[model samples]
Target: MRVLVCDDEQLARDRLKRLVEKADNVEVVAEAANGREAIEQTQEHRPDVVLMDIRMPEMDGMEAAEHLSKIDNPPAIIFCTAYDEHALQAFKVHAVDYLLKPVSLSDLEMALSKARTLNRVQLAELGKEVSEEKPRRRGHISARTHRGLELVPVDEVRYFLADQKYVTVCFSEGEVLIDETLKDLETEFGEQFVRIHRNALVALRYIEGMELATAGHHQVRLRGIEERLTVSRRHVAGLRKVLQSL
Candidate 1:
């Protein structure tokens, strides 16, 4: 199985790589010096497993893992960290296993064994869900619009605009305002959505591409949809990353 090792320290990374090599079925395919690199490598390599460090420059492993978990066919993650305090959060994000630093070969092997088993189960479950949901295409977004609750279906939807208090579900049929913020929708419908701004969430399949506009701004072009959605500067990097993965 292909594996990616991520650690800020060169010694730790090399140690993990050697340990992975000792395993019968596992191979260390790539290494990262930080969480940001880990995320980039994850997109580029698509490894079956990631040995992630908990803390690093640019981004923390927990945050990167959280984002990585949203990707389609995400690798089974095995967090390799020195801190034991983060074990609970690691498991909360559905990590396959956690190995403390100065990792033992036996422990690494055990984690690898568990990761292989868990990855199989995860892939199977993902396939089943995708087949079962048949995820609605260009369907209505349930939200509060005008003065009351409203449902804005695909044909009518112009775009989804996010504000601090709510997400305005704009459609040709008329806009429906939802009380829930973009973050709420992100957690609820992450599979069908892409984040363009910290406050904004756009349907993934609807996004055609991104346009570089004047004044260092970027706009998202939606497929079968004319309205352009604004991409926040902070989220532009993440948007670009996700697009590249697709």
Candidate 2:
């Protein structure tokens, strides 16, 4: 199996490369020094598997994996990191396996076996052409309003504001405060919404444009909505890119 090894440390990459070469069925096809390079290499080499390091400069492995997994024919990812804290999150993203640092040849073999099995399963699923089905629109967003347990539809939503604990779903007709977090909503309705801040996720269709305000702050102007949304500095570039693509 073709494999790509990614790590910020040159020594770590070299060590992993030797270990991968020692594997009977594994071929070390390429190597990357960071997450950005890993993405680029994955596109170019189309390796069957990638040995990813969790933390790196420019982009973290989790973020890179999220983007890479969305590619047409993404390689199976096997996270090789020293930190064990991210094992659960790694598995949540459908990683083949998580191998701790100083990974033994036996551990590498086990990960490889799992990756091959997963690749076969994914290919089989892809071979069967599933009929295109329309996704059902959310009829109501369960929220705590004055009446409690209020159901709000898509049209009624103006924008979603994120607070410390809860996300306030504002509507033209009436606002409803939901107990859900912004990250949870992002996963549920990523196609219909855009994350304008780490704390906020807003409906894409309602966004009119963004304006540069004082102190280099950015504000999102929503169509038919009176409240202007704040865009965090980290998300400004991404929001601008999404708007330009629209």
Q: In every candidate, how many clashes are there?
A: 5, 0
* Distance from true location, Cα of 17 in model 2, Å: 0.3
lDDT of 2 by residue, 123-218 (tens): 333322110111222334644344423446655676777878777888777676766667666766788889887777888888999999899899
Q: After superposition, how far is residue 220 of candidate 2 from its true place, in Å?
A: 7.5
Q: How do all models score by TM-score?
A: 0.54, 0.54
For residues 8-38, write the lDDT of model 1, one tens digit per residue.
9999999899999999988888999976678
TM-score of 1: 0.54
RMSD in Å for all candidates: 14.7, 15.1
Candidate 2 lDDT for residue 73: 67
List per-prediction Cα lDDT, in the order shown.
Answer: 0.73, 0.76
Number of the top lDDT candidate = 2
| lDDT over C-alpha atoms for residue 29 of model 1 | 84
